[model samples]
Target chain A: MIRFDQVSKRYASGNDALSQISFELQQGEMAFLTGRSGAGKSTLLRLITRMESPSQGQVIVAGRNLNRLTRRQVAWHRRQIGVVFQDHQLLFDRDVFENVALPLKVSGYSKSHTERRVRAALDKVGLLGKEKMRPGALSGGEQQRVGIARAVVHRPAILLADEPTGNLDPLLSRDIFGLFEEFNQVGVCVLIASHDLGLVASRRRRIITLEQGRLIENREQRADVGPG
Target chain B: MSARDRKTASERSRTLPQHSGGGLLSAHLEVLGDSLRRFAAAPLSSAMTIFVIAIALLLPALLGLVADNLAGLGGNFQDSARITLFLTGQTDDGEAVALSEDLRSAADVASVSYTSRSQALAEFQAGSGLGGIVTELGDNPLPASLSVTPSNREPDAVQALVTRLQALPQVESVLVDLLWIQRLDAMQAVVNQLGRILALVLGLAVLFIVGNSIRTGIEQRQREIEVVRLVGGTAGYIARPFLYSGLLLGLFGATLACLLLMALQLAVSGPIDNLLSLYGAEFRIRFFTAVDALSLLAIGSLLGWSGAAISSLTRIYASPP
Candidate 1:
């Protein structure tokens, strides 16, 4: 669970990225954060992960105040919340299996467990058969899926994706979104930030839209859940 | 796949997240191995780094050998280096014996003995094969003399004895075998001081070489490190491998230096031993002892570790997850 109460973030460069934002996300919930470029969508996610602190007000995730946790605790907190970057952040030199197994390895998983989980994560991404391939050898969609596999390889409690489908075709985008929906149905919270208004227009889920560092809309999408 | 049988391995791993990175032993070895592998993958960098460290370590080791030999250069044949005190020409037998005894009791004297004129004549006659002829002539023209052999140690003590014997009323002359041993001692001291300074300078050079290598390694793996941190690896986790690499490089460099020095010793050992034998002396060259060898290894490893630690400071601090 994440709660942002009157959270305001101002950069040192004298720009207000987020202004007095108040929001809460419950367990097993799937939500979309929509905003134009520079509207603080990533800033919100950064606060949730405590990558950066709020300028004012409280930002609490999973019960601990974002400001209260030590750097070490913040790192541990990050372990439970898997983050998928827009660029997929894969190390090119290493093979796919190692890339996905990285989080598990770092969290000190046993070899057997790491191997099993890394393969499973790859299977979920439909790339189990390509475990040894390098990122450079994979297609854009496959690479992104590898990134997804890496994110969830530890079976984190939540998945925070920033424009995960930003570069994918419609079919792959649908499949990726379906993947998120599947994980959410299995009790993993999903918070996706994107500027693709048309893509989220049909999804029957909560959409929080921000404009000029302030949330303008926080409503459940009642219009449609189109094209599976 | 059916949900019942489709459980992800990631879930299985998540069931126990604290046992995967291997225990501390494997953890350390894995890091060391990775570093070695990375270095091996780049033959040029590995060779260059090893060469620099080897040269740094060898300079000190060779100079230490030189210093050791210099200190022992003249001390090897100590007794042959002292002055001998001879009794006066006109001294009577009784007077020569008494004077020899008195000199023997002197603080600087190691030993003294009176040689009667008759005994001196006999020794000369026998050596010159004029024994029967000299025996016929009889009364012996040789003067009674004392052979005084002072202690081979303490240059100042021997010098003081030379002055005291010359001042003796009954004594005739004094001879110091190798008066320049005092100069040898002074030269050894200077060489030792130079060795220490040279070693210090070379140590800094090695540190810089290793530090620069580690810095390049950090730059090369910047993205990999970023990805590691993103997945929950701490700075310590990331630093462990580089530190191990540095230690290994240092140890290898020391080994290289020692091996080279050993080869040099073997190559010149025959000539060096022959030269000493020509002087009718036993002066065998000593290789490094076990303690000295271990010290070399430890010093090299420490230098490497320091370099890597210093380099890691900048890399870890600057990296962003």
Candidate 2:
């Protein structure tokens, strides 16, 4: 669950990334954040992860105020959530299996458990056979799948993905959404930030649109089409 | 959520039971293993750092060994610090014998040997190459003497013994050439002080070498460290591998230094033996003992750990969200 109460983020360069934005998402809810570039979608997600603190008000995730978490507690807080980056930040020196097992390793999972969980996550992402291959050997779609597998390997209660399918075709983008849907069905809250409106609108899930650091839309999609 | 999905989720939880044995010891071994692999990946840089540390440690170690040997040589000189007392001409042979017996019972005297006047004259004539000239003089002039060796080699104790003997009624004069012994002792002091200073400076160099190595390692892994921090890694967890790297560098360096010192000693030992034989001294160079090796290893590792810790702590705290 996440709650932002009149939160605002101002950069040191005299720019307000997020301005008095307030929103809430219930547990087990799935939503998509859509906006143009620099519209504060990433900033909002970053606030949830405590990567950047809001300049005003408060941003709360899983009932803990982001501002209140100590340096050590912030690390532990991240364990409860998972994140997928657009760049698919996998260590090139390691193979697919190692990239997926990273979260479990940091969380102190046993070797046997890490292996089993890594394989299971890879299977869900349709990359079970590519576990031994390095990221450089994989295609763009497969690499994104590896990132998704890594984000969910530890079975985090919440998953945040930022433009996970930005580099993929429409078909691959849809498939990536399907993976998020699969995780959400199992009671894992999911929030995705993206610019692909057609793929985001087709899901008929909740959509929160942002415009210039302001929350412009906070509603679910409908089956019927409205004005263009 | 569907019942089927719930079933799988519950099954996953059961299969991936919480890690029960997440002890600190396991964490250490895992981090240490990771550090070894990282070092293996960049052999040249790792070897260069290790060699630097080895050379730094070797300087002080060799200095200590040399100082010890020099002190041992000074001790050989102390062995000959004996006082020879010549009796007055008026003192009879019986009185000289009595004085020698008394010296044997003295607490500070180790041994006393008496040489009668005639024997002294005979010994002087035999060695001085003046037998014909001394025979022309007719009368024997050498006085009876007592060779007194002290039990304690300390300068203060020997000086006190000499003073006590000089005050004896029958003794005409006392001969105790302690100036050279005192100079040798002072030289030994200077050598020891030099060793201490060298150890101090080299110790700091060891710490600096480890710190610089770790700083470079941190910079290279900055991206990996950011990712690790984002994925629930504490500062301690992220720094664990670097700490292990520092430790291994120091340990391997210490081993290399010890080996180098031994090799150096071996290379020069033959010549040293020959030189000692020429001086009629039975002294040979000694390498590090077990205790010395253990202490060196401990100190080297400690320096590395502290250096890594300081850099890691500063880096972790300096950058925050």
Which candidate's lDDT is highest? 2
Candidate 1, residues B1-321: lDDT per residue as tens digits?
Answer: 235123322433343447533544565676777788898899887988898899899998888988898767767756556555566667787787778778778766778766787788878887999888878876676667667777647777777767877898876777676458778888888889989998999999888888888888888887887777666676777887788878888998998988888888889888988887897776656666777778999999999998888888667766443
lDDT of 2 by residue, B65-158 (tens): 8788878877877888899998899888888888888889989999999988899989988999888887888998888888999999999899
The DockQ assigned to candidate 2 is: 0.41
Q: Interface RMSD (Å), each candidate?
A: 5.8, 5.4
Please provide, for model 1 over A44-68, each residue's C-alpha lDDT reduced to its tens digit, 9 standing for 90 to 100: 9888876678899998766668788
What overall lDDT, based on C-alpha atoms, would model 2 receive against the true structure?
0.85
lDDT per residue, candidate 2, A143-221, as tens digits?
9999999999988878999999899998898889999999999888899999999888888788999999999999987
Model 2 / residue B106 / CA error / Å: 5.1
**Can you give the lDDT of residue A155 in candidate 2?**
88
In candidate 2, stretches whose alpha carbon ends up further than 4 angstroms from where it belongs are: A222-228, B1-30, B100-111, B118-141
Q: Residue B243 error for model 2, in Å?
A: 1.0
Q: Which stretches of candidate 1 lie over 4 Å from their true place?
A: A5-16, A53-58, A68-71, A222-228, B1-22, B79-83, B90-170, B177-179, B288-291, B318-321
